[model samples]
Target: VSPKGARAASAGMFITLAAHVAAMAPGTNIGAAHPVSVGIAKMDKVMGDKVVNDMAAYARSLALERGRNADWAERAVRQSVSIHAAEAHRLKVVDLLAEDLPELLQKVHNLPVKLNKQTVILKTQGVPVHIMEEGLRTRILKHIADPNIAFILMLIGLAGLYFELAHPGVVLPGVVGALSLLLAFYAFQTLPVNFVGLLLIILAFVFFILEIYVTSYGLLTLGGVISLLMGSLMLYRTGDPGMAVAWSVLIPAVLIITLFFVGIGVLILHSQMRRSMSGVSGLIGERGEAYTDLNPEGKVFVHGEYWQAVSEEPVAKGEQVEVLKVEGLKIFVRKAS
Candidate 1:
């Protein structure tokens, strides 16, 4: 029985019609059993027609077995027709109309039901209907199965792993990423995830990381953004809207993640391009005082240490010199102008 303000559409309609005693609350509506396609792959007209015809036949059979309106059931499958509870009862599409669960139980009580070729009357009167609660594991799984939540987890995992890889020894990001990624994968087991979308998302991250090493000039970043957007939009393959990511989450997530990865890539590139600060290369172009006079050879004090130096021109003692190049414990120098 449908609750108030609820609907029994698509597969719900089939379930309702197939019941021994179909029911609906006063504000509820039913019908609209047309099959919808949500996959990237499209069904041809012929195959589509066959599926629709098969469903229509099935709906008609259920209606006939329950002695309801077979024509309406067929129309619900073929034309996606729907009706309110009162109208459904008028059309003989439903066996009863109930205001609530208690009323429904009272109304369905003593109803004749055929079981194993034997007619059995329902004894719902004073029969406590125990509502089974979802187990903790199942509840958590269902929560994680949400497309947005799963997508967020996947991104967090990727970002964490990327951060850890970029800066090794940052143990927190790696641990978080690994855990989030594992959880996301587990959630994917329950969701209708498209492999193409998953691949695109992974490819996007690859591009983001490559942007740091390769001279793409933002081309890789742009590609990553496009891939991420497409991946987010096509993450879930389902006819049900509830199973897909919401736009509110997708838009901000894509922008934020893209910017974050791009920013990290830029920083890496900048740091790589910067000059060395603490090696022999750092000694080049340093000014120093001659420690001893020499005929094109002398000792110079540079960077707080004395080094053997040879100059193209003669340099006197106490004369300042500039280091040119370093070669095996010796430094080439020129007299300071």
Candidate 2:
């Protein structure tokens, strides 16, 4: 059995326990089939204790069924100990262990086995080996479980949603974000996720958005950055070392997220200080020519558009004037000095 830790580890351990005759390859591991509670603040320790007890019981039962030393198996479960194939076979933890699957199968072929209290003879001397293939869902779930892929999907989803919010009329980003979120959720369903950590991540995004809306003297932005880092760190909590996110992924993700938010924050700040470039407000400070004499009201041509105009000073036709304010269907203008 190749049980490590987490969901697959538990399932693999259960499968191994169900086998009539079990043999492990050299250097193979077989312990720690327990779920780690993630994200739950209150019940984590309780869940850990329950899982340990349950796994220990299961290991003891399996050891007893296989006619192996139950005490050692129980101890292994309790202490999360894994032994080498040679040691396991010598200690009777496994039977007929071999360096490879073919050798193990050869040794087990035509051997007498007891399963579910029934004795049966294996007709496996010349039988063909059958291998099970993973289904589509399993394959996809495996891909999603990859830390790098999940991280990338998260970034893409966030970026898409941000783009959609910034430009409401664009439907692509919304669609992409929705799909990405669904994928991310599916991945999370199979992986051990900390909801509290996820909430912190969402809170970080909220803070970033608030920074854009309200100039907070960088306080919100700084808090947002810290929250984002902590959330990313807590995203996955598998007890197994192999399943955890690699430092390569974490370092790059942190750098990328930091740069992305910093760039966005700077852009937002710049936008806040920028003058309007669209709408009637845009017309202010723009010079125009009076098409007709303006005592208080007349017509002016600006940017290829004719507009009703008014001025405090008299302006002759074809005189250059600057727009001061816009009123209902008319513009207030001042003669160019």
Candidate 3:
């Protein structure tokens, strides 16, 4: 019988230990399933101890019900041990073996089963099997378990936020950033995330921002690139195969991010160095008509607006003049002679 909790709950220990006369398929196995927590704090240790103790007690109770060796069951729980089909049969943990589901069902038919102080009879002979598929949430979590998808979410989240910050008031960037962040969080929920590595990634972003303001001759940019690469490499460290981000994904992602930040930084610097394209600076060297005679100061028409102007040379009314400088609301001009 499969237990309520597969590996991470005390209930599983009790259920798995409850079979007085157990049988298994040819290649099946039974074991204790414990939670994996790395880099956890003192609270984690305390919780783990509590779970282990609870599981051991449950296993002992099941052993008592089955009239088997309770001490051995308790020991197994305490040690987080597992036994395969052959070993389990040798130790009297399982009573019989079958080659297929039909055979197993035939073996289980009319067997007396004890569950939570209730004695029941299982009628499994010739019964139709029903299989339930995973729900949407479970399916989504399974997809997020993939390292490539998780890494992609992280990259998109960072890029969207960067774009939103660089160009404020753009609603699209903010919306995309929020969506990407939500997806990243969903991915993180399933994957083992290292907070220190996350902190390093955040620090890299800070360096990239600082590079924009502080002229560090690419020093801050280089540091940011290194930090980002290291942080991505160390983001997840579970022993699960294919759970960690691939080097192929990491190298390309780092290159893209570095190029993005450097390109943005250069663009920002260029924008800073560029002259104003509006107001007085925009009018310099622009041709306008002298509305009145230019005796050092007169009214000139430019860009559909009349302005008080001063000229370097003598000019007649309606003569075209080029703007040389702007003093407050006034324009200084030279005749287009």
Tens digits of per-residue lDDT for model 1, 1-337: 5567899988899999998888888888898787765433456789989999999999999999989999999999998898999999999999988888899899888889987679999999998789999999999988887778999999999999988998899899999999999989988876667778988999999999998889999999999999999988878876543668899999999999988987787778788888776679988988999999957887999999999999989999999999889998999999988
TM-score versus the correct structure, for each prediction: 0.76, 0.79, 0.63
Candidate 2: C-alpha RMSD to true structure equals 4.0
Ranking by TM-score: 2, 1, 3
Q: Residue 15 of model 3: what lDDT?
A: 59
Predicted candidate 2 versus true structure: per-residue lDDT over 1-337, tens digit per residue: 5322212134565566557787776657565554555323334577778877887888888878778867777766566556666676788766756666577678988889996778898876667879899999889889986766775677678777987998898999988987887777766666667776678878887887788778688898889888877887877775644555567887787677767877887887788789888888888888989999999889999867999999999999999999998887899999987
Residue 6 in candidate 2, Cα distance off native in Å? 14
Which residue runs of candidate 3 sit more than 4 Å off their true CA positions?
1-34, 37-121, 137-192, 237-260, 289-300, 311-322, 334-337
| Alpha-carbon RMSD to native, per candidate | 4.0, 4.0, 5.8
Q: lDDT tens string, model 3, 102-153?
A: 7778887998877778989989877899979999998987877576777777
Name the TM-score of candidate 3: 0.63
Cα-based lDDT at residue 148, candidate 3: 76
Candidate with best lDDT: 1
